[model samples]
Target: DAARQARYSFLWESAERMSCNRLATGHHRDDQAETVLMRLLCGSTLLGLGGIRPVDDSGRLIRPLLELSRKELEAFARCNHIPYAEDSSNLSEKYLRNRLRHKLIPEIERKYDPAFTRNLILLGEEAAFFRQCLEDRFRQLRDSLVEWAEGDSPRINCPAAAELPLVLRRYLLRRIVFDYTAGGVILSGRVLDAVDRLLVRGTSGRRLDLPGGLVACREFDFLSIGEKKSAPTGAQPEQIEIKGPGKTTIILGGLRWELSFEVRPYEAGTNNVFFQKEGAEGVWEERFDRDKLKFPLYAGAWRAGERIQPFGLEGTKKLKKLFLEKRIPCSMRMRIPVLRDSRGEVLWVCGVARSALGALSPESTSVLLVRALCLPVRGFTGVTIIDT
Candidate 1:
């Protein structure tokens, strides 16, 4: 209605009312040329090169003569014997496009060949084609190795992704992290190189915090994407052990800890309660029937391919599976220690599950209690543990 009023005020009162499917404009290739130059000088990114698009989300605006040249449009009007009034105001040098069209561009055409207009159009067509090709390459890169998980960071299998051509690889990595952060930002080239460096070197546990609250963590020998939080920052993995009647403290990944042993009556659910505490959540202690058990039983760090039957479950489960089911984020899974006996039997998955083998029994009389906690590691420098 406002458009109708404006045109009517200018004696275009006889003009048809603007409809959703129909819009009236006189823009032509000259206008396109002006827009290209303007945006090139003022735009922030290269995607702006496509010039005006075919479809406008707002249905009221339409370009009926986008493909028409000024000479062709004038010829069409003459052939149809159409009578249309020209706005006298357009003759003035008030608008930038008008000034470029009337003065600057005409001067360029005069100084050079009069065929500059044709050359500019050809150049624009080439640029548009190049833009499309780049977009297609980016799309292929996106489809190859990108994946998203609910309420979590995107995961790109870095080893597989690293094999892509560097141009596409860099684009895809930026796109993954950008989408991971909801398009809020892009990672610096230095940060992307840092992650690529880790992947190329086969570094499994390396990570870097990127712009826009994004964390690019390496997992499964790949890159896993996630968000940074305000508190309880992401924690790293550690393997610390407590010996029978021995106390020891070690710092891993910036978290602090001390493990000490205490001997007491073996009672069902007694020591289990202590293991559930802060210091004991990752700690494991067990009491075996001395007469029925072997004295050479062992307790220490986990060896690879370890499996254990969790408490209350009859069958054995992979220690790795236990970590996954517990919703332990990828970064902490490797470093969490597993406790096993001398016969390659797992007694507990620290901070996670207690195996059925050494689980407390109702008639148990003697027991060993183990505790794991996050404490301030004293006098130990150069430990960086971030808990996510």
Candidate 2:
């Protein structure tokens, strides 16, 4: 499975890289017949039995030889004196397909019927026809039921999906998975069944991790399928010195941090010292007690075995433990910005926690405002603050 997936991935990557729209594969009728038999023996669905599609739904992958038998192709190649090499692995019994092609299929053809290959091809054609019909119906139902939200990730209304028939529901979920991953990964039958069960009976906040760093989250009434949160790479420690009321900018973890220092009167409105506003959606800004914090603040990525005295907490807690309680992905923990004092004590973890030392009080007179914005990644539009 892994090897096949890698080969297809390479094919797609090469196509995109070379700006080629069409990818052609030499999958012949014999291969199609074998695939149908193999899938049938594996108890595959009707769509699976459809075997090798001449053209993928995306209409980019084409199988020009799908209707031609392997024998016919070989005969033509010999007549033209075309050079070719035989793959030894095709004769190995270790692989199920090889066993079927060499042993089981030949046995069935000899003992039961000589026309077994032709029958399998016919079955594939019939299955393809039925699958196309089912897909049309599924598309209609999806149009009426699935509600897409505006964001990088795609979300669907689980409540509406639950109203669909079990088979349709599974199909819709699988389609969403495929679309979200850009065909990079496919959900297996077991995974699809698990997701279907979750859609029908699972409660909100439940989540399932799919392949290719994607996740399916069950919200109150919808399901969100998107890329998993990953931390920034190549982050290094930085220091920002606040001499007085001034502004400075520092870059870390592919993000820009604009620090504006000011001495403002302490407000009595909220106990929370950190006042934040979205300059624009996903752009973060926050205020802290500048006077209370120690000077020569260190800014850097999170480090292993670090501990922080979180506000309202009795004592310092392990950063890893805190991240777990916050449900932060492991890959993102180090990517998060960490603010520490000259004494090496953590003052804040960006979008997550504020140290007790940085908390505002009635006696606090000066405030330090920090604004952060991340440079857009390849697929994402903006940075989302992972609030705890």
Candidate 3:
């Protein structure tokens, strides 16, 4: 198994380095029969029982001779004067495949059906067809079921997902994990069972540690799934300074945000700032009373206990409270930029809330139009604003 893994890794790496589009292997019908038998003996789903795919899920790896028998290949080689060397390890019973090929398979073939291996191959083909049908169905339902955020982290609407039949729920969850891990962990039943419990009866704030460092946390309305993230020791969160009447671009947590600062006459009923939508997205573009703000603002991660007197609100509100009210999952709150003025007062909490400090007024002229475009990163459509 280790050797097979290493060989496959090398092949993938080599193909990428060489800029090759497709990778082909020498796996044959006998290998498929052996794999099916092994999977059945060890317990596997119909997808696993499909054995070696002629074309991998990515459609890059191909087994051209997957349906050809070993005997047929050898006969063709002999007749055409084509020489091929066999692996010496195949004769060793130390390996399970070798044991199956030499002892178990021969015994079964001699004592029972003469076409036992062929029957297994046939079973694998049928299973492969079944697996393809499942994949097609999954593709159709994946988007509405799974919401991918933070570039790769996948979450779901718990109540909506829970309403699905158990089989579909399992399939959806399995595909999500498979895509995130890039098929690293295989044939894992552990995550399926644990997450099912989480969805069915687990209360909000409850969670299960899934395989591959993946975590599933049940929120009030969302089942957030993401890998464990360890903060670096002795590393401080970098605070980027935004000093400009021009555009400044920044990358944070695998996302790109463009912040623009322009001092222009505030035109009534016309806000040039755009973030792909209205309502909450308007927060990304705020026309602040420029005369009120101190220059050279700093943008950083949200600090604990930070409060802001949000525009149109009477008093101050905690950043945490605002986030909860906005229904922004806790996992994303920290990554959201918290913009502050030079005096260290909160000016805007990025896409969440804006301070009433520099809010535009009817009498205010030459407004500071702060526009932010979130760039539709990783399927996350956050506010790209014109105001603050």
Candidate 4:
């Protein structure tokens, strides 16, 4: 296989160097039949059963003899006195393709069905047509259901995508995976089934590792598919000081952290860290009391033996314990930013909880709202926002 690929590469390079538009090969009907049979034996899908195409749409290669049988081509060559050398490898039974071509195909034609080859050709053509139809349908549905995010991953709207027919769902997911991976990986039937199951029934924060360093993650409302790499790394933990009402961006733990502080009127719907007694009403954002906070506010990565008095909890608990209870992957524990006071006391475990020191109270006149937004790197997406 390596040698074959090298030869093809050489041919393609030679064509390009010569300013040639196409490199033609002598693949015929028999080759197509063998390809179809091999794919079927290997439990291929309809797309795989489509067999060999006559012309590669990329315009780099063509097989003009695909419609002609090998026997006919040999007869024509002999009649025209056009001598050609037979490849010795063609007779070898060591390769699966050679075995099918030299032995199995002939045996089937002799003993069972003389029309087997013709039927295989017809099946390939039908499969190719059906594959094209499926691809077109997939594209139509994809445009409506899949949203390509700014990063390398693409997000599929679970509600709308789940409503698609089962076959279409599978095809659409396959298309998304292929496009994100740039066709470098082909998902197997089992993997596709697993992904479909996740799409249909998986809860938020669920993840599945796919081949070729890719991962499929389920957020609250969408499924994000992209390459899986380790979370970003950073130097030794450093405290980022925040004085007052302002916005600052910090690079820590391999992520871009955007922290904004403001004293805004507490609205019922907005996620405002309130200093007033009302506390937080929204689930997506965290609320902290401005008056209770100690400056300068420091932001750093989680450390060993760190504990936080998570709001509404009985007492202080280990940060590691909280992470375990939440099922946050270990790889992401450090990447989660931890906000602290000047004394190194944990305040708000960003996206996790706020320490008791900063709890909102009715006596407070103004509420300080601190918002932390963590942006993922190139291959990652679905930034988590923790609210307690």
Write the candidate numbers in order of decreasing TM-score: 4, 3, 2, 1
TM-score list, all predictions: 0.46, 0.54, 0.66, 0.73
Give each model's whole-structure lDDT.
0.60, 0.74, 0.77, 0.78
RMSD score of candidate 4 (Å)? 5.9
lDDT of 1 by residue, 53-106 (tens): 444546645677768888788888999998777778668898666787788779
Predicted candidate 2 versus true structure: per-residue lDDT over 285-388, tens digit per residue: 55678677666666677777889998877999988888777766543454566777768888778778777877777877766665555544434444445654
By the TM-score metric, which is better: model 2 or model 3?
3
User: Alpha carbon lDDT of residue 239, candidate 3?
Assistant: 73
In model 1, the Cα lDDT at residue 3 comes to 52
Model 3: lDDT to the true structure: 0.77
- The reply for model 4, stretches above 4 Å from the true place, is 231-239, 243-247, 252-255, 258-292, 300-388
Judged by lDDT relative to the true structure, which candidate is superior, 2 or 3?
3
For this target, which candidate reaches the highest TM-score against the unseen true structure?
Answer: 4
> How many angstroms is residue 196 displaced in model 2 relative to the true structure, after the best TM-score fit?
12
- Where does model 3 exceed 4 Å of error? 2-31, 53-92, 101-119, 146-164, 180-187, 195-228, 232-283, 287-298, 312-315, 341-343, 356-370, 373-388
**Residue 119 miss distance in model 4 (angstroms):** 0.7
Q: lDDT (0-100) at residue 154 of candidate 1?
A: 67
* Tens-digit lDDT string for candidate 3 (35-104): 9999998878777798888887688888999878899999999999998998898989898888888889
Which of candidates 1 and 2 is the stronger one according to TM-score? Answer: 2
Root-mean-square deviation (CA) per prediction: 13.4, 8.4, 6.0, 5.9
- Model 1 error, position 360 (Å): 12
